[model samples]
Structures are given as C-alpha cells and as structure tokens.
Target: LEVATPAVRREAKKNRRLKIVGARGNNLKNVTAEIPLGTFTAVTGVSGGGKSTFLIETLFKAASRRIMGSREHPADHDRIEGLEFLDKVIDIDQSPIGRTPRSNPATYTGAFTPIRDWFAGLPESKARGYQPGRFSFNVKGGRCEACQGDGVIKIEMHFLPDVYVTCDVCHGKRYNRETLDVLFKGKSIADVLDMTVEEGVDFFAAVPGVRDKLETLKQVGLGYIHVGQQATTLSGGEAQRIKLAKELSRKATGKTLYILDEPTTGLHFHDVAKLLEVLHELVDQGNTVVVIEHNLEVIKTADWVLDLGPEGGDGGGELVASGTPEDIIREKRSYTGQFLRELLERRPGGKREAAE
Candidate 1:
C-alpha cells in the first residue's frame, strides 16, 4: 500500500544523528552507523545479520549506560555520540508487565488508581465513609475474603496440577458486597474491570484521567482486551503494545529515544497499522524511534533505513546500505533493498517514485 512520508522527513534540516562508531559487537565487523534523531528508522537485514549486535548490543546498551547511568556495558564499540541531545531512552520489548494475576492493563497504565479515586468520590462511598483503599481488591477491607480478593480459589492436588474455581462468596467479582454497592452509572467496580478497553473508553468518556489511558490502549489496537485482563494471559506483542501505550500516555519531553525489536511480531495487519500511527506520532512530537524490523509495511513507512549484512553470521555485520528507502533500493548490494523495491513499486507515492 502507498505509505505517507513522515512529517519529520520534510523538516530534517539540521540532520542531528546518533552515531555508533567502530562497533565490533558479536558478529558485527568494525561497523559505523548514524541514526537520525526525530525520525522512524528501521534496522533491517537477514537473520543473524548483526541487526541485534549493532542496535541492541551496541547502541541501546551504550545509550543506556551513558544516559541513564545503568551498569550494563555495551558491546565493543569505539565511541557513541549525540546522546546529549536525548534526556531519556526506552527499550520497549515483549516482556510481561507483571508476573501475578493481579497485574492488568488498568494497574500497569495507572488508570486503576484514578478509577478507585473516582469510586471513592461517589455519594454511596461518601455516605459510608469509604476511602479509596476500600475499593482495592489487593487489600482486606473491601475484598472478597473467601478468595482473598483473587476472585478465584486455588485448590492444590498432589501429583495433579492446581485447579482454580470462581469464588462462591463474591461470584468472582473480587470485591465484597459493600464495595460493589458503590456504583457509577449502575456499574460496579467489578463491572468496570470486566469492560473491554473500547467499552471503557466510552464508559469513562467524561473522566479525563481514566479516558486518556483507555484511549491510549485503544490507539495501540488493544481495544478488545479487558481493562482488567490478567497480565499472564497476554501475548508478547500485546504486552509490548501495552508498554507503548503507557509511554504514549506519559508527558512527552520531545527528547526521548524509543527502541523496539520486531514489534510487529504476532500482530495482525490492522494492528500493525495502528502501531505505525503511534510510532509516527512520537516522531511528530520530536522523539526518535528506532526499530529492528523485517516487516515490509514498517520498512516502507520509515523515514530512514539502515540495512545490514550482505549475508548472515560470519559473513555479515557490515553496513550494506544506509539511507532513505529510496536510497537503499538503489544500492546494488542491499538484499533488503531488493525486496523493498518490489513493495515500494507496488504502490504509487513519493517512495515508489524514488525507487523507480
């Protein structure tokens, strides 16, 4: 499909870059790379082509150590520059946000706190003198004591795996009757948690804090997920996107550098489109996003491309091509460009014209 150029491309006058000089990390040769700030740049190549070695082992680790004071050392590299232009760096990976069942999108994104506060402000809560803590399922007061607020009871079986059944007391609602009694628009706290992110977006439209968080979740194509779905149930891509949503909702400093490795893994075509929109919006806000990607849709839309490897492993790690998609496609040696040329040519746009 025809992809629109990012707005950053139109105004890249100063051309500030994050330079990785003389990198020899893992399978990488003594390579040097320049990643432009405030653009969506993709690092692409064959498997084991040192994409990970160059970006993750070298760039991300080095940037983290220098900028955040992290002790993790980067792989062998001569020098890194232009880190001063960034105040923060985030690596959004596909790791679970929490290990326990109590963790969910609402809790991770901090929307649940405001949801509790809003519940506490209700007239029924005020009349009963119920504090915000009373609505918490994690605590004792308003939780279903029968299940210890897990909404389910786990029964141990020797030799057999543990079995869990819904709580008879609260009927898997997590909250006790008193907490459930405090309602907003006829829906209880449990009812709110049961709502999908898209449902919650409309349900809490009048509430700014809650609405904004739900909106971010929806923007990342997580509208179908329950507001309180267990973190353990989420796939890797879903978890990664949730992290992206949380970051998107935060106040942008316009100097944050976001790095992602294969974010499109396990995503549907529609979901990938949504992901791109969010990434480009970050660039529009003057934040730089560098992704190690192989997806054609993602590569086509990137403002810049860094194609590594004429081959994989021992034969790879050199910077085979580095430029716009147009520039990369013209380089005779770039395998990424050979494939990218077909994609860009299939659609009519400036990217396609440049490829021609």
Candidate 2:
C-alpha cells in the first residue's frame, strides 16, 4: 500500500483523461493524476490533503487560463494534456450571485425578462401604456419612490446596525400604485416575486418560458425559497444551487467541464438525490462533472474516483488510488476506498462479492 509518487510522464488516452504531470502545489509532493473526461469524477481526501490546491488552484486555474483567457496564474506544474478536448471549464462555487437586495432568483435566471414582457403585453398594461421597463425595480419610472424600489427603507442607527423598515408608501411591494394596478389574473409582478418557487411554477404553468425556469429552480430543491429572496440572504449551498439551476435552463454544449467543490454541502439526503439526477443528466449529455467531496453518498455514485493521500497535512498529498469506485475499493492506501467498500457491500444482491 505504498503511495504512488508523481509520474514522470503520462500517456494520453483518447477521449478519456485530462492528464496532469508533476503537480507540485501547497503540500502536494509532486503529485500526478489523470482526471477522466465526460464522466462524474470525485476528488476525495482528508482536509488539508492538497485536494483544493491540486484540483482548483492548479488544474482548474490552468484550464481556465488556457480556455477562458483568465488572468489567474496556475500553480507550478510541469504540463497538462487534453486541454483540446474541453471547450470550457466552469467553476461553480458557493460565491454569492450578488451583494445587493436587488438581485433575486428571477433576475439571475433571466426569467424576469420574459415575465415582465408578459406583464407588459397584458391588456391592463397595454391600456395604461406601460412598457416592460416600467415593471423593473432597477429603474425609476414605475417603482416606489419612497424606498426607491427596495421595498424596505434603511434607517441609520449611528451605533447599532441599520434598521430596515418596510416602505410605508408601497407596503413593501416595490412598485408604485399605478404599476401595481396592472395585474394578470389578479396577481401583480410583485406578488409573483413574493411567491415561493414552487408556487411560481404553478402560477406560471401556462407560460412556458417563466414556468420552465421556475421548474428548474424547484428541481434543484429550492422550492421553499421566494422568487424575490435577496442573493445576500442565501447560504453558500443555496447560492451554488441557484447557479446550477441557471445553467440547467440553458442548452447544453455537451463539451463543458463543470467543477463543483463539495456540492453536497448543506444538502439533505433527498436533496442530494435530486442533485445527483441533475449532475448525471449533465454527464449523460456528454459534459464532464468533477466534484471535490467527502460525502460518501456522492463518492459512491461517481463514475471515477481520484483519491489523494494516505493521510493529511505534511504526511499526505500522494495519489493513494485512482479509477472506478470498484477499483479504488481494492486499494489499501485509500481511506475513501475503505468507506466505499462498506457502501458496495450493502448494495442489493451483494454486488461487491460478484465484482471481486
């Protein structure tokens, strides 16, 4: 069970791996690995085991610098091959979509554009000569002047935190009285934003564009969240899911490489199941998904596993094992393999025994 040292050279396999050679970053002791292409790959190891340094700082950064023309400098590595196979690399992290309250799910997903168009086309809006711009809170035309379309007015408390009070003029509706009067089926745009994603899906069922985007949100297990919920209010996991939903709504290129760091964070068992379905759909469509995760459920489902380290910190950073879950389970040096062994054993019909 001796750890595998960094390989001097790696042979490229057609349509298989994006190979790395002589990867030396952070605590990584000249680690070399091959990441499978067009498959769900998991990079699992103990904390501080150089997983992030190798994958994110080195591999992803290098790929981004090449494909995206990013200014980021990758970590020290001899070379990386198979860049030609990938069209783009997307790092879908837990970063906030926006810092202000003005950014919401509808706006982030571009669903608001179509929704406003629909509202503008309504007989009430047409008769009133209201344009699509009139429904937007970002502009000044039809939004509440009292709170400046924020729905809440900020009261400065010199020593204490600023107090946010609901706009008395529009009662937190964000729109002016005249704008609110233009409604579709007795529900205004503000009312739609206030509804949960699940509710919005049902309300806009007939509208294909809006309903499809809302359905993507619900599919990602954000059904309970309000369409108008501020981006700042969302947790890291929630923000990541929102981004995922936005990507899902678009047509797949089938050549995109999606890198997610611990996507299972803050997700419940049922939520994880929904996430897997979405991720697998991406892989099935000819896209690649690479996730850095410790969650065994996620690890077990991966088509390929790149397990780094027999330990953490200074004692680790070597490639402990690599390949399919079945292959990794046979490696003595991989702690991840030991856990996967238990999972494989518990599967119905005792599939592990037959695989042996």
Best by lDDT: 1
Instruction: Give lDDT per model, in order.
Output: 0.88, 0.85
The model with the greatest TM-score is: 1
| TM per candidate | 0.93, 0.92
1-356 per-residue lDDT for model 2 (tens digits): 11111112122235567988999988888988988777788899888888999899999999999999998899999999988888889999999989777888899998899999999999998988999999999999989988888888888899997777888999989999899888888899899989999999999989998999999999988999999987767988888889999988889887788999999888778888778778867776678889999988777777788998878999888888898788899999888999889877765431111010
Cα lDDT tens digits, model 1, 1-356, are 33454333433427578999999989888999899887889999999899988888899999999899998789999999899999998899999999766789999999999999999999999999999999888889998998888777878898997777888998889988888998999999999999999999999999998999999999999999999997877999999999999999999998999999999998888888889989988887789999999998899888789999989989898999999888999999989899889887775554211110
Angstrom error at residue 284, model 2: 1.2
**Model 1 clash number:** 0
Superposition error at 20 for model 2 (Å): 1.6
**Residue 85, candidate 1: how far off, in angstroms?**
0.4
For model 1 the TM-score comes to 0.93
**Over 4 Å off, model 2:** 1-14, 155-163, 349-356
